[model samples]
Target: MLTMKNVTKVFRTEMVETHALRELTLEVKSGEFVAVTGPSGSGKTTFLNIAGLLDDFTGGEYRLDGVEVRQLGDRARSKLRNEKIGFVFQSFNLIPDLNLFDNVDVPLRYRGFTRGERRQRIERALERVGLASRIRHFPAELSGGQQQRVAIARAIAGDPKLLLADEPTGNLDSQMAREVMQLLEELNAGGTVVVIVTHDPEIAARAQRNVHIVDGVASHLDRGPALVSPALRTA
Candidate 1:
């Protein structure tokens, strides 16, 4: 569960003050797959940063899993983020020199998991993305879709409750994009709270709920039951 109540973010310099977000309020329930769409410069990036705990809002309240975040210190914030939120980005962000296994192993190491535990998590995450066979392959050797899968595996390696994806399919071709979306849908079906930030309508349309942002304000454009997963429909 992620909730933002009347949130505001302002960027200030000696010359001017710019408001990236203005009283933006949104809520994502657990077991929900949500898509956030907006035009360029519509505060999408700002919202993603704030939502993923990568940046702080100038005003208003943010609660993740019912814990307020505005008052948490840097270390506490990092801890909470690592334990609760997993991030996937447009660029994939894989280290070119590291193999798939090591790439996914990076964040788990930060969690201070024992060597055997990290190995277990890395293998399990890679297996989940269907990349366990390529664990020893470098990012440069794989196709774009495969690299993105590696990124997804790394994000899920921590077993996070919330998965935040920023333009996850932006760099892939249509076929690859569809594959990635299918994988995301499967993950969502398994009850991970999936929040995707994308400019593609086809991608956004797949989500059960859509939130459109303009000039820092958000509006809900809820989809129909066709988009809802079987588990959700039954629930």
Candidate 2:
């Protein structure tokens, strides 16, 4: 569903040129749960930003769901990103003042959905994250994991075709991390293409495939069949 060929990102100044990504090539298919693991300065964030259409690459080609992103204008890119990609950040980027329902409703509002539709999407998104009853609760009132769930809810409310998560469980305890991972797994099973960028080995191990980046390029990729939890195979 996502393809990148010879992707290069360069940051140039009068004094120096920094190459954040160098000919990075990778593909993520529909319904795949892929973990991107890399050390600092390895260009993981750069790749994620480009993949999500948040930033443009200096060179190379990127096709998202068959559309070549390089040819699109900013407005078109923004529209496609809002329509096709969902993001979960390491820091739950929830609005501090908005309650859970409103936080989830913010993006839907931008989509120009009717009030009823926005409300329905918010509730259903929260329900999927197991936070329906806490719709009125504020972010400060919830645990770290709960807050992350709210972030995930906000992301998935649009029913995006691709889900991009960066350090999704970085702030939670082990149990909460497991819970959040399980939720992501469930979503992937339901057919959303999931690409997670993380540093935690345990977290990387849970994904169906692993893509390791180094020196701004994909250095390793697991070529085996999907590696889902055995319990999920029967479910």
Candidate 3:
């Protein structure tokens, strides 16, 4: 679960100041699938960075998984982020020379897992993403969708409590996008907390909840069909 109360982020320059997030208050419960949608220059990216602990905010409070993040030291924040959060970026962010197995292993190594533990985690993560067979393939050898799946596998290898995806399907075709979305949905169904930031309306609509950001604030929040559907449990 994540909570942001009156969170504000300001970027200062020599002559101008930019507000990336303006007193944004948002909460995501455990095992929920949420989508954040907005146009370019909106605070979507800023919010994601803050939520992922990749960037610092200028004001207000952020409690991730019940720990107050605002006052945590950089070392503490980094450890928490590495242990609890997973990120999937639009760019894939894979190393060119590394095979899929190595790509997923990199983060596990950083987490200081033993070699055997890393191997097991990597294998399971790849299997979860349906990429176990392609673990030896390089990023360049896979299709855009497959590459994205590998990226997702890398993120989930550590069993992160929260998944943050930014423009996950930005470079893929419609079919590929749908495939990726279905994968994410399946993950959420299995109890992963997934939060996606996208500009695509169709993608946003499929999530259990949708939040619209505009001008550094959350402009609209919708519970979407999942909240009212009898078949879906309230997360």
Best by lDDT: 1
lDDT of 3 by residue, 1-235 (tens): 9999999999999999999999999999999999999999999999999999999999999999999998899889989999999899998898989999999998898899999999999999999889999989899999998899999999999989999999999988877777778778888888989999998776777787898999998965675553342312221
Q: Model 2: runs farther than 4 Å from truth? A: 223-235
lDDT tens digits, residue span 1-235, model 1: 9999999999999999999999999999999999999998898889999999999999999999999999999999999998888888999999999999999998898888999999999999999989999999999999999999999999999989999999999999877777788888888998899999987776777898999999888999976545444532332
Candidate lDDT scores, in order, read: 0.90, 0.90, 0.89
The global Cα lDDT (0 to 1) of model 1 is 0.90
Candidates sorted by lDDT, best first: 1, 2, 3
TM-score: the better of candidates 1 and 3 = 1
Give the clashing residue pairs of candidate 1, or none: none
Q: Sort the candidates on TM-score, descending order.
A: 1, 2, 3
Pairs of residues clashing in candidate 2: none
- TM-score for each model: 0.94, 0.93, 0.93
Instruction: Give the TM-score (vs. native) of candidate 3.
Output: 0.93
TM-score of 2: 0.93
Tell me how far the alpha carbon of residue 36 in candidate 2 is from the true structure, in angstroms, after superposition.
0.5
Candidate 1 colliding pairs, count: 0
For model 2, how does the per-residue alpha-carbon lDDT over 10-62 read when each residue is reduced to its tens digit?
Answer: 99999999999999889899999999998988999999999999998999999
